[model samples]
Target: MAAPYRSREGLSTRPGAYGGSSDEIQLRIDPMHGDFDEEVSGLRKQVRKLRDVAQEIETEAKFQNDFLNQLMEKVLMPTALRNELPD
Candidate 1:
């Protein structure tokens, strides 16, 4: 990427915006680092909770399907045989 404007002149020896000269630039820490970690941790917790709920729903569905199959075998099979056996 190109800069907004190219500087033909080299480094200049002048006073900086702060108390020091331009050669000595100050390093600063970003303020959002802690907030970023907190947000990630919260998101992880929500994902874990969602996974647990999905597993529970899957287990309940399997159980209900098995119960329905058993009920059909016990209740409907005899009725179907009786209908075919007589008027």
Candidate 2:
């Protein structure tokens, strides 16, 4: 009894590193003609911007976690351990 989306092979929503140029390639959505190529280019630029932001956030979170862990081990944990030691 497993969920359809979860087979342990990873999530289906994660776009692959090389998912191909479908996003870059354009399709004529309207017969009358909208600049579909330009639209796709804009969408690709926005996706790139979003990816950069996500990477920055991930880096910041990692830095904060590492800093807190170091502080706990170097300062708080040492002091607590020292207090607990018998004379």
Best by lDDT: 2
Give the C-alpha miss distance for residue 5 in model 2, angstroms.
24
In order, how many clashes per candidate?
0, 0
Lowest lDDT block of 10, candidate 1? 3-12
Error of 2 at 52 (Å): 0.6
Local distance difference test scores for all models: 0.61, 0.62
Estimated TM-score for each candidate: 0.56, 0.56
| C-alpha lDDT of residue 71 in model 2 | 83
Candidate 1 residues 45-82, lDDT tens each?
A: 76699799999999999999999999999999999899
Model 2 alpha-carbon drift over 4 Å, by segment: 1-33
Regions more than 4 Å wrong, model 1: 1-34
What is candidate 2's CA lDDT for residue 79? 84
Whole-model lDDT, model 2: 0.62
